[model samples]
Target chain A: MKLSDIFKKKNSGDVAKDRLKMVLVSDRSSCSPEIMDRIKNDIIEVLSKYAEIDQDGLDIKITEMETDDKGTKSVPALYANIPIRNMHHTAK
Target chain B: MGEVIVITSGKGGVGKTTTTANVGTGLSMLNKKVVLVDTDIGLRNLDVVLGLENRIVYNLVDIVEGNCKLKQAMIKNKDNDNLYLIAAAQQRDKTSVTPEQMKKLTQELKAEFDYVIIDCPAGIEQGFKNAIAGADRAIIVTTPEVSAVRDADRIIGLLEADEMKQTQLVVNRLRPDMVKRGDMMSADDVVDVLRVDLLGIVPDDEDVVVATNRGEPLVGDSKSLAGQAYMNVCRRITGEQVPFLDLEAKKGLFGTIASVFKKK
Candidate 1:
């Protein structure tokens, strides 16, 4: 490797893209991760009372939705893929 | 029928008026009949930018209020017989004209002209709604800044919500020197964030200020880089596929060393 290659700089364009990506992720979600985290905790808390929910394999993520409607629409949608290990055995 | 295009920017002072004037004139120079509409009521500038401020008699409000005919209110360009202007009302605000009225007026103009380019006011409000009401397409102008790009993203969202199917972006005032130094955002940076189809990239040039102040669009000035850029945008708009302009800054000894390694 040449000595000049060692001093090669990270372009500002790359820096700008990195910064914008973080900002846009939050902007599109319209909420901070902390807020979403609290909401997720509350959901699990409430669900545990009704039935036992698998605590270890819970997945909740806020992401964009793609539509098949005629007019183009891009929006954030909450997707939760939770695995229920087993339901609480109830007594009749 | 004519195609109605509105040149807009969510934030102010990003060259919406300048882009409208140049693109309108550029299209007219290509033998396409174009009418430049100044929808920025109460703060009109397209006339001033186009150097037709002194010719305003019956304005947009006058035509909408039935006080004057559309042709009587339209001002013909001295440089190009095909170009015209419909100055906005300076005394009243944006509320004077409704979207329905704007739509009707645009339809009328479409029958007579090949293109009706509306110069939209900054901000997404009554002025913006009214501007796009008559527009079949939109051209968003933005500078290479975080604030400008953020506002542009919001605007693209709003436009998408409005079901505007045709929209493009034009990046303005890009300084090649600053871009080379990594001190400012480049065209690619803006495009990566905006995620809109690239329309044109106008280089930052001082000749634009002089030409704008003189009420002469730089599109006619062959020597001006900004003018040539606008001309290229015009050709692309007319269904001609033109490659983007090369605004790359010349590199020095250090840049040469880094570039040689970059290829490897």
Candidate 2:
């Protein structure tokens, strides 16, 4: 079978493959996506407890991107970004 | 210098104990003073595999409890005078021994022997934790099945978490014919998933079963194919880059000719 035929995104099986990749990444990193979501939620809760923070401006995301190697594909490393508001918020 | 190695797999029945017994015997055959420790506690079988089960008067728990000295618990291998075994307490579970005790025992063994191989129990619980606490390196055994590979990967992750530096893979019970027919995963396929250095591959040999049933490890049996593979792994462990054994069936001339034409 051709590689393209096996890996096409619209093949429906590709969804399962992607899910497996996500799961394997989480396993390799020793951090679960479920736990990461809980952590983000708790951070948001703590921010709300202190003051009114703009929820729309809050951005929490975790991503994995592979770096192109010299004629070889490399393993993807995890990246997480969580934006927090500064103490000096403009007074309403 | 003595090195402490642990053989472990997160899944059961992946030949962890068999690997430990054979490798220990192989190392001992090389004139290296080797000791095999069964950390499985209640599920202990290393002694049986080494044909020293009947000689174990004092178990590992006895040594840990101070009822007996470490020397008293060790059963010397009659076949290889340099090899010894510390049999686990079949009556007691893993909690009976702590990681501290294992560390102290391995430390003392290090002073006396050249290699200390521990057969870790299945799972990621206290037995696994205690087995790896004193290990300098690890050898993970897995079959060609997906479940075995997945569990081996989890065990590797745990070993990494403990900061166990060196880890190698031993693909056991591999059938090369099945791999060629796509009925089973190839050694290379499993290696890609685990991403670990390949140590050795043991074929699905019936001699292994006969040896195990006779309470003798395959290491000393010249006719056993698995025995030769275990010896090769022992040489590799001793810093020798021995060529991997050709356990797979040789392709026919037709297949070879086809491959040559495809390359053209």
Candidate 3:
């Protein structure tokens, strides 16, 4: 009801759509938060051996991505954002 | 033989039984001999929904256990001669019937009826397994809620894993006004998230509850929007191309004003 809130409020339908998209990713992958955490840690450990990685900035998730030109087809895709500060010169 | 279609939703209270009754009745109305089998077992409801509760002399378990013949178990609908219902045994649990027995029963029903519509119980348990055992296709019903859609996604995955690939989605209890106000998910939103072919969408109509209480499906009412939606779904099931209902256009005076504003 406030003047400032009128322009900034997001529609509930859009909010629901976003939430469903996020929840269904994990639901479809059958991956729990615990399992995702473990996967994230394992990936971090493997990458850290050869490169200096930012553990705090690392982002990973399973999301649905378009598979076709028309965007008619989609499939679950695992995306990872690993920020590396520097690479080790010597092979481990 | 006839096609055995299972009407299911992994989550409860999403109108699976109501859809089964209406679709089966609508198919029968279309002159197709239809028999609705209630596979929910302990929570038998199709009989009550169809107003054939008092006529049950024999049930599904009785026929499976050799206590009675199939003909004796099927209760004729009061409304249509072509429509019949095989009531589930109320006292017995879902464990009473195995998937093999369910398949055999549907096979037998398929020979006699044009469509054998099985109303599946909620959840991904033994009850769910028995219902889909003999289905040639599936109609997964879900509301425009987060929990229902999530459960529907799970049901779709399970059906695909079981190799029942000919599955469709029915988004029930949709509210057009709410969707217009950006307060509820539209049928398209549900289909987009579920990634399934949309069969039809039933708007959230109060007449559905009235029809359920009277043990008569709204599909035959002709006046109820939800009934028309169900009829359209049945038509699509039979491979007929029917346009989806224009729910927004039916919104009376307020809708007219909204349309005028949009044009300007």
Say which candidate scores most in DockQ.
Answer: 3
Can you tell me the CAPRI class of model 1? acceptable
Distance (Å) between predicted and true CA of B79, model 3? 2.5
lDDT for each residue of candidate 2 in B1-264, tens digit (9 for 90 to 100): 699999999999989999999999899988999999999989988887878878989988999899988888889997789899999999899899999999998999998999999999999999999999899999999997766777898998788879898999999998766666556777887787677999999888899998999888898566766888888989999999999877663334446776899999
lDDT of 3 by residue, A47-79 (tens): 888999999999999987899999956788889
All candidates: TM-score: 0.81, 0.76, 0.87
Preferred candidate (DockQ higher): 1 or 3: 3
Worst 10 residues of 1 chain B by lDDT: B246-255
Best by TM-score: 3
DockQ measured for candidate 1:
0.34
DockQ score for candidate 3:
0.72
In the predicted model 3, the residue pairs found to clash are none
lDDT of 1 at B120: 94
Write down the C-alpha DockQ for each prediction.
0.34, 0.09, 0.72
Ranking by lDDT: 3, 1, 2
Ranking by TM-score: 3, 1, 2
- What's the distance in Å from true for residue B18, model 2? 0.5
Cα RMSD (Å) per model? Answer: 6.5, 8.4, 4.3
Cα-based lDDT at residue B108, candidate 2: 91
